[model samples]
Target: MIDMIQQFASCCRAAGLRISTSEILDCFRHLQLIDISDEMQFKTTLRTNFIKNYREQGKFDQLYHLFFHELRTDIEIARSTPLGSLVKDVLENLNQNPTDNPSKSILDFLSGDPIGFLEEIRSIQSEGNEPMQGPIKGPRSNLGSLARRLKIMLQIYAVQESIMNFLAENKSKVSWETNKNLKTYFSQRLDRARRYLHEDPPAYPDNSSHVTSYEKYLTQLGERNFASLTPKEVDEMRIVIAHWVRKLKDTIGLRYSRNNRGIIDVKQTLRDTMKYYGVPLKISYRKRPKRKGKIVTLCDVSGSVWSAARFMLNMLYSLQECFAKVRSFVFVAEMDEVTRIFENNDINEAIDKALKEANISYNADTDYGSAFRNFKRSYMDALNKKTTLIIIGDGRSNYTNPEEDIFDEMREKCRRVVWLNPEPKVFWYTGDSEMRTYEVYCHQIRVCGNLNQLMDFINDLVL
Candidate 1:
């Protein structure tokens, strides 16, 4: 029982749940007080000792269900039953054929130990999105995992077929009941394996604040989530954003003018006094060097993230004169600079062209780590002390490595890094999101799920 608990804990850890050795000991201690035969009591005791946070309960429940219910068997039929020898014989025969050879993990699963197979699944699910490092580059996506899964599925099918063929050939040697039981047991185990491959783990519920107080404008659409917008609402939203852009431009100009007066430049004044023969006959007023704000925006154009990013990009370019230079980038698993798209075309036209023409793979999964690495490799020079780097995305890297070090480097190079997450604030740290990992490096993180939130951020940014 202790070994089983430890193994289950290992599985949970592999699936990205945080489990400690002390927790395992505590679980063992707790189990002694509960009736082990009572499934509910046993599960509750284990859950209490193992799970630390309410947010992690969903993952705990999934692993628990998978380990105790789906993977458990009533008896050790593979070793103790009379059919054990028959199963071994069949496996030996299957192994003899090189072309139909299954992966060692699959074979281990068939032989009754599923740990190897579970590890394979975990690895596949958590595979990194780092691109191939060579002269020749190719797009990266989830397809590699899918292909591996397909191969496993096919192998399972082959194993089932081989077992059926073996049973048919040796039917006379075993009783009818024995054959039926053998088929049913292997069938169930194989089916369980297939189901596990498809079962995506649930993400923790996001507990972030829904909305912040802002002056309400177009109350209905302004407050509505960007992901929930309809076609008509999106069109209406463009008009509203254009109006805001104009207002923001005027506001930026006014703010700049209000703060434009220079402080007394003592050195320049002293030099000018020398020209006046060291007398206070002529007074010289020093002129202020205009501060130019440069902005570099990296926007994730994947799925619903694009909904919020498009509007942000639109407003940024529409008020481009407010900034000395505005560079735009869009990314899915890879990033491409779209600054030129905006420069040569109208703001709306540029946005449309960026979506269609940017050298990015739209079908690939979101990989912020890869995008950051790519940016560092190609556009590291674009960042400077005067550049405000705004990253717009949901921060979901699909269980890939987040490469927070790269993000931290980015923060160092830029004036300030602001993350605008389109996902609800509650969902920022959930599932495959790398928000928490990258959050520490960001100057600010705002939940830009709606127009109001977006406006609030832009307002603060320019004014």
Candidate 2:
């Protein structure tokens, strides 16, 4: 029992759940007090002891489901049926030797110990890949593991082929219902794997440098996904965001302090020494580089991506005091500059006003090709070596021309282009998402769905 618990904990960590040795020990002690035979008590004991907060529960529950239910045998059924032994014997006999092939991992997955399969999927989700080489200007992330998953999916088909062949040769011994049940079991596991491969992982918050407000509700709202909030929570989020703006203002002040000046300005030093009769008693240095307030953002303000964009726009509004120029655009099928709207009103009111007044075609679908084309024609001049162009959207181009060439042009015009994807990494290349194509153009790409991600990105962006 102790060894089983330890192995389960290892799997959880592999799947990116932060479990500690102490939590594992505590879980062992608690299990002694509960009826381990009772599924409810067993699961509750593990979850309560290991999980820290509501936010982590999503991933904790997923791991628990995979470990306890998917991998284990039902007690009554195990006792009544000899099919378990029979199936094991047949699978082991048919299972091929470990070799360097995509089928290798699939075979391990089917051996009923999911650790290998879990590890493979975990690598995909967390982006275990080599860094990009050559003049490729963007990230080298495996791009939601689509290419890898495609291979694994093919391997699954190959395994299914083998399983069917085994069933055919041994049809006399295996009942039709037994064959159906075996196929069903394999299908279910494959389905689970598909979901893990394609769906979003939970938003795991970073508590390293935590921030909170006197209003507990507002703080909680800050932690929640912007899309999940209610109208009441939205109002509370604005209050919390205003607090963040004030904090950033202080950070900006400290950054511009004279004490933070750069390396000594030799030319300025020579000029100052001449003023002092070449005594050279005092020195002059370069002033801190002025804050580049030039912000060009192409925000997708339609569909679910809108929720995160609106909050980001609110934060940008607060930053107007820091930047000399802040230019923003809203887009769906086309784009429109909303800098005037931000300049004219309070940021909070400006958000609501921009949503209504901007030429954002809410009824139309998102088109990155169209949007970037517009940006190139009119707003490309807005970019320079001093500016940071931020693209805030899910990168879902609906199978249209991604126009990655235009992104190359934009990157040339700007110091850096940052892609802030609100969608989770697992869904990066799934469905209509052109994330794989768009990622090649970004100087940096990050998943920014909730407050912690947003806060961390802003901190790195400015300070």
| Model 2 C-alpha lDDT per residue in residues 1-463, reported as the tens digit of each score | 8988888888777776778999998999999998999988998998887777766777878888766776665322334577666566556766542332335555555554566777777777656455666888456776557787787777777677676677777878878888787777667666766666666656677553353434565556667887898898778777777888799989888778847787898988887888779977777778877766577888898888888888888887677666667788988988899989888898778888777778767788789999989888988888998788999999888888988999899998888899999888999989999989978878899999988789888888767
Local lDDT at 239 for model 1: 87
RMSD of 1: 25.2
How well does each candidate superpose onto the true structure, as a TM-score? 0.49, 0.49
lDDT for model 2? 0.77
Candidate 2 stretches with Cα past 4 Å from truth are: 1-219, 262-286
Worst 10 residues of 2 by lDDT: 96-105
Which number leads on lDDT?
A: 1
Clashes of each: 2, 0
Q: Give lDDT tens digits, candidate 1, residues 329-439.
A: 999989999998898998888898998789999999889889989999999999999999999999999999899999999999989999999887888778899888989
- As a TM-score, model 2 comes out at 0.49
> Alpha-carbon error at 350 in model 1, in Å?
0.8
In model 2, what is the error at residue 253, expressed in angstroms? 1.5
How high is the lDDT of residue 328 in model 2?
A: 89
